[model samples]
Target: MILAEELTKILSSDQVTQNLTILQQHSQDESFHEPHLPDVVVFPKSSNDVSRILSFANEHRIPVVPFGAGSGLEGHAIPVQGGITLDFALMNRILEIYPSDFCVKVQPGVTRLQLNKELKKYGLFFSVDPGADATLGGMAATNASGTTAVRYGIMRDQVRDLEVVLADGRTIHTGGQAVKSSSGYHLNGLFTGSEGTLGVFTELTLKVYGIPECVMAARAAFPTVKQALNTATSILTAGIPIAKMELVDSRSILQMNRFQETDYPVMPTLFLEFHGNDNGLEQETAFTRLIAEEQACVDFIYESDSKERKKLWKARHHLSYAFRHGSPGKHIEGTDVCVPLSCLADSIEHARKKMEEADIDGAVIGHIGDGNYHTLLVIDPDDPNDRKKAHEINKAIVEFALQHGGTCTGEHGVGLGKIRYQRTEHGNALDVMMDLKRLLDPNHILNPGKLFPMSSPSTLNIN
Candidate 1:
């Protein structure tokens, strides 16, 4: 098409394409949201390439969506307006490594596994693992957190700086290498989870951690969800430095057993981990065990062997896919909500009741240590009734979270999936956010049809 030809002139013929296969690939992500094809896809290898492309698209009023690994469950990378899709696949490069400062600089296309693999040689690691081997750019855009977040923190906390190309094609850096500064607005936090609506990330400077001296993984099963959640809260309340704490309901465990071929008991389970020196870990584990026993935990299995620990976490990481695998022809619509710790059990119980009332099929799994949980709703994609019921359950759960000082999404950013909750969750603050969007992207060319407009935008105003 004409757009591809023009972008080719700006970059190279090889970097720009209207190939039907490539367009189809960029149309959707792992989300249940319907996909839309972009008019063209452009591959950029450097910040200058991204800057020039943004400039050309901005002048002509074109929607530009940044594409990453396409692993997002919220359609964060889908190019709904069909303009120019910026694929950063060629920009995968680890630019610098400062082991002394426990930091690393990397291109947007670099995956979490890729960075962690390299950091292994230096005895350091990047912690914000959202599973799925997702690109670091996508993780930052979503502000992803995973099992380890209870200890190390989320993606926003780890990002030291970001090099961004704005809507007008101007290049700017959000922050520097300094550990802390009071110099300016905290732009680093602003852009990190902007969901590609504000700008495109070209490079990221992130903090890393030294691998723990002693690491252990354990599984504790409880008779009920409440007991498991109570055990997790108790461990946290007692000041145990648990590295990773996850909740997998009995139904989810059934799916995990079928998928991973394990003989774990079908019960509400808390997958736990501890990090510290040998002596400290021993004392912490003992205390945690005592707390679990008090909560009537039926089984407490611990492992220090590296391979066994990997297998344990592997099952947790792939639990979502397991749900999909178990259901023959159903699509999974995962709901993410984070309530206050005091309200987590109540929120989850509410979700369970709503799903029962709607007669929907799904399982509950989450990073319960931080009061975040997800209900994986399975529905027949071809059945409108089924889809409606699943969404209804989702709405009830999100409303419960919002009513109790919680967010609609804890890790997944406001993509097309969570736009309806923006007004209620942010109140008047959402208007200020929209003003910022207008100020930064006056033409609305940067990722239009996302994080605004309550519903999908049929026609975006480019004037």
Candidate 2:
């Protein structure tokens, strides 16, 4: 147990909240999971403070869970074992910007919107947008990717370097500012998607892109998801370099129309964005139109004005909110699966049929250019049967993805929710992961019982 006097001497009493209510509030994330409050919540102001806190926690064998914006869907920030919740809200700062180099240094707490607002002055932007205005640290932790990821790539691709404080109070820098390197093992890759298990990310250097010379947003309505997915696959195979391609099923279209007070046809829709010079954009648009016609698309509408394009994406971005609007007082549970381009159509159809048979209420949306899709299930926690049915549907979807050549999660890291499927997905590689976990965190103090389940110390030994 951590002594009060020791903690108070390290941080101001006010900086460390011992109040149960406050601790409980910081425990869970934005999901339906029951709150498991930390024993104490500490707001650290700097990397040194984080290092000191970790040192104390390591010595005492107290679990430490790093807390970002708490906007995560999988309870990644939750302190399930009840020790210390290191909230980095105070560390929120944009450290530096190098416009010429097309990179920026930011504290973990700075959000995507905050960075973009600052970067707008340079006519540059960070592209790994995960819909929610999540913190850069949290985004890096989960390796989050969204619509733009089809072209700009995920958080891992954006992150050039990270200053991470490990379990035993050692702070290390992973990677450098260079565009590419084969210098050593990829520590950046190891820590980026570790979900705060291996270390606490204090600072990050990330890649940024200049605003496109020309941008266009378009929507294609298909008679069926098969047609929509086919159009996406066709666009990819033809090497269109589409900036973004998103699929929204008819069920979600209705929910969006109701929520946004706009009347878009309730059909499986494909939302696409193309970024390039004016001529390139025109060529891509013409190519997409031809392919859409080949796929028997019902309609293809284009929005060229930036404001109008933003409005179109705004509606699509608020899809989770739309589902919540239809099912009042219900929480949204989203599960993602990515399969090979050849298998995406069949896998999605299989998932759709399963949802219909199980009588689940949800919508399918995805970055289909990457063969990644999510089925959003709205469930009322008050109804146990509804929750169970949603879980069953999610499990089946994961199984289908795995049986085919796909991952259980495309971008969302394996926090508590997907930990059970880690072994099933990775097999013996799961043992290697356990070994890495034990090697980095011998005390098991960092985000205990997450990413992977707690295994006996002997089971984790690599040699």
Q: Which one wins on lDDT?
A: 1
RMSD of each: 2.1, 3.3
Best by TM-score: 1
**lDDT tens digits, residue span 167-190, model 1:** 998989999888888988999999
Pairs in clash, predicted candidate 1: none
In candidate 2, how many clashes are counted?
Answer: 0
Give model 2's TM-score versus the native structure.
0.96
What's the TM-score of every candidate structure?
Answer: 0.97, 0.96
Which window of ten consecutive residues has the lowest lDDT sum in model 1?
Answer: 454-463
